[model samples]
Target: MRRARRTSGKAQRREVRRLAAASADPALHFLLLLPLALLHLSGRAHADLAAYGLVEALLRRLGPAAGWLLAAGLMAGLLWAIGRIRRRRLAWRGGLLLAAFEGVLWGLLLGPLLQLCLRLVSLPVAPLSVPGSAGALHGILAVAAGAGLYEELLFRAALLSACAALFARLPGLRGRDRLLSLGLAVLVTAALFSAAHALGDPQALEGPVFVYRFLAGGLLGVLYLARGLAVVAYAHATYDAVVMLWSSPA
Candidate 1:
């Protein structure tokens, strides 16, 4: 009995380590984000309607079945590419659970942090508004999920990667220069993220909201760099969900 318990404890510890390591893999991030993106693209949410209009238009052009098939293939290719590039095997189930836990943890932290930031800046913190109706609540949740997935996919994964690559190509960049280049890439991507919000809703740019978003974007960017895409994506989603729930009228 003692031997068995010892073996089981060792196994549990090893599994925990594996799961924690797997959570940092970008391939896992892609896998987690894909489903949310699909849900959003399926025309269920009003929040991303304008931003994802091009995707919606493309899907309409292709028709439902064909569009879904295309999206699946593209997502598969992306997963394959990320796995191949990283040369890492996935621990999908464990990674997913860790991602969820990380998101919830970060969500809890973000509210207090945001309030502190606002207080420091002497800005009045405004409550996020969400519709009280059941249907609208569902749509808002979908939008929050979509924002968590797609925004991180675009800003952190795609834009940050592109910027880093571009910066790496600059002649005479080496050592600390390369590090500085990557740092700059992160900042630029965060700024773009804040700016993109305003593109869809100009009202978001008003008052302290823009500053709040910019600060949030910067924090997310740093989190992405430190904790990988899955952590930040889910954190963003979880934070939005909490805010929406709090704002919804009783």
Candidate 2:
């Protein structure tokens, strides 16, 4: 009996260690990713601070297709990483369904509703009237496809999973760990999403309009949790598609 008890204790300890190593620490993960996200998103503004040459230099290091390809790679990696945790049966279907649902929600509901609300406030409207130009069409497509695959993969799939894993490790947080993890992931990802946009245009911020992006971030977070990352990405893509299609000439 004594020997058996000792073996059991050892086994338990080993399992705990495994869990800890595998656990997702949202704050830690966010810190790790924050710098990278800023650097990537601020590629434009950074260009002004001697970072412009760096951006160009980096891009120049690769072929013209590299940026798009890098985005594609991120999408692929996200799917693969998420698949590691997701049940096999629902992987593809779930992602597709999510994408579809998000597309409808953003295009038919959220985007329009927000537009109306903003209009009431006399904000300059993004017509989303039509595909403005070929480049715009391409950008829209990129955002849509990127949102569906890359965004979901990064924010929803990877980040959420990491949080869940971390939550499982802390004994004190056991009962509500998963929920806590999810919330942290959403908040961090949303912040990054907002920051990513904020780093752009420079003139992008004025009045209270910037709040829209934050709200959109929350929506995206909820979408990922309820529907899956793919759905949010789809919604994101559709929204971009419309905006690009209708954007005024530069």
Candidate 3:
């Protein structure tokens, strides 16, 4: 009985370690957010997705039920392919709970702190109108959630990595200066991330707004490097949700 207990305990500990690793992986982040793909198909709560555009013709042609299944499958397949590339196994339940907890923890904490910094510098801080044109409360939430997942994938996971590699190849940055390379990468990406708002609407490129997004983007970039996609995405989504709710009419 004692030997059996020891074996069981060892197995449990190993499982815990694996779960911890998987929870912090970008590939697992997609699996964790996989349900959002299904949720979006209800056609009530809408989110902006690049994949949705690719699947739009299918959606228009098929019956609602068929469209949902086809789209869900395609989304799942893409996630699975990415997961295989990253070598992540599914570690749901525990990882998901941790993701949500971290989201709530970091979201509320970082958001207000960013605002406090803005206030200190007297750079007009206001509640969201987040990227705008989301319309309605649900729409705003959807956009936040979409931005959290897709934007993080684009800016943090893809562009950040690309920038780091590019910086490493640059003249003065080529030598043992990892910190400088990372710093430059983060700054450039943060700038681009902030400026991306102009793509949604040119008029939103106000001075204060740019600064606000730049700060927010920098936070997200750092957090992504530290914690991984799940945490930063959820944190960003949660903060935007809070902002949108607070800003919307009663």
Candidate 4:
């Protein structure tokens, strides 16, 4: 009995270590966010309109079968890379809990702090226009959720990765140089994220709103690097949901 208990304890410790590592893996982040991405795609959410535009355009040009094939190939490639990098089994339950905690943290803390800062800077932040009808509310919620999944995928996963790769090619970039490269990548990506919003509607790109978005984007970019994609994705979604559902209308 004593021997059996000792073996079991060792196994439990190993499992815990595996879970902790898997929780931080980028591949696990993609897998966990996959269902939300599918939901967003199915719901036809407008919040991610700019994010999905290029893919949608490609699909239209290539036709459904080819488009699907391309998408599948991309996903398979990503999964393959992830598998190569992170061979351990994922801790789905732990990841889910962490995502929820991050969401709450954003909703209750970081988001409010940003808003307060905006107010102090004399930039009147506009409330998201929540629709009066239930159907519209549901639609808006879907868009908000989609925004979380797609925006993070584009900005953090794709843009940040691409920028990092580009930065890695710079000569004499080692150690702190690498860190500086990543910092620059984050700033550039954050700037693009802020700018992407204005592309949809030029009039919405007022001084205050632009500044607010730029700051918000920078914060999210920093969070992405610090906390990994899953936490930041859910955090973005939760922040938007709280703002839309509870805050006064614009």
CA-lDDT, candidates in order: 0.72, 0.51, 0.73, 0.69
Give stretches of model 2 more than 4 Å off: 1-102, 113-136, 167-172, 203-209
Highest-TM-score candidate: 1
- Order the candidate numbers by lDDT, best to worst: 3, 1, 4, 2
Tally clashing residue pairs in candidate 2: 14
Superposed on all Cα atoms, model 2 deviates from the true structure by an RMSD in Å of 13.5
Candidate 4 deviant stretches above 4 angstroms: 1-18, 45-48, 70-87, 119-135, 171-176, 247-250
Model 3 bad stretches (over 4 Å): 1-19, 40-91, 132-137
Screening candidate 4 with a backbone cut-off below 3 angstroms (N, C-alpha, C), the clashing residue pairs are: none
Per-model TM-score on C-alpha atoms: 0.76, 0.49, 0.73, 0.74
| lDDT per residue as tens, model 2, 1-250 | 9999999999998765544332222222222232233433433222222222334576778989878976787666666655553533323333333335445566556577666666777776543222112354344454344433445555567765676577667686776747777676677766665555544444335444455554566677777676544345556556755665556366
Better of 2 and 3 by lDDT: 3
Clashes of 1: 0
User: Residue 202, candidate 3: how far off, in angstroms?
Assistant: 3.9
TM-score winner between candidates 2 and 3: 3
Pitting candidate 1 against candidate 2, the one with the higher TM-score is 1
Give the per-residue lDDT digits (tens) of candidate 3, residues 1-250.
9999999999999988877766775555666565543334433345655424435655667767875787688677776757664565546567667776786689888778888979988988844346544557667767677766667778888899899999999887788679788888889998998887776656547888888888888888888888887788788778877887777678
If both were scored by lDDT, which would come out higher, candidate 1 or candidate 2?
1
Q: What is the C-alpha RMSD of each candidate to the true structure, in Å?
A: 4.3, 13.5, 5.6, 4.7
lDDT of 4 by residue, 1-250 (tens): 9999999999999987776676676666766676556655556744446666666686788876876787798679677746745465567567556655765587457567777878888888753222222145565556666777778889988998799778877776654467788888888897888777876657446776667776777778888888788878877777776766665355
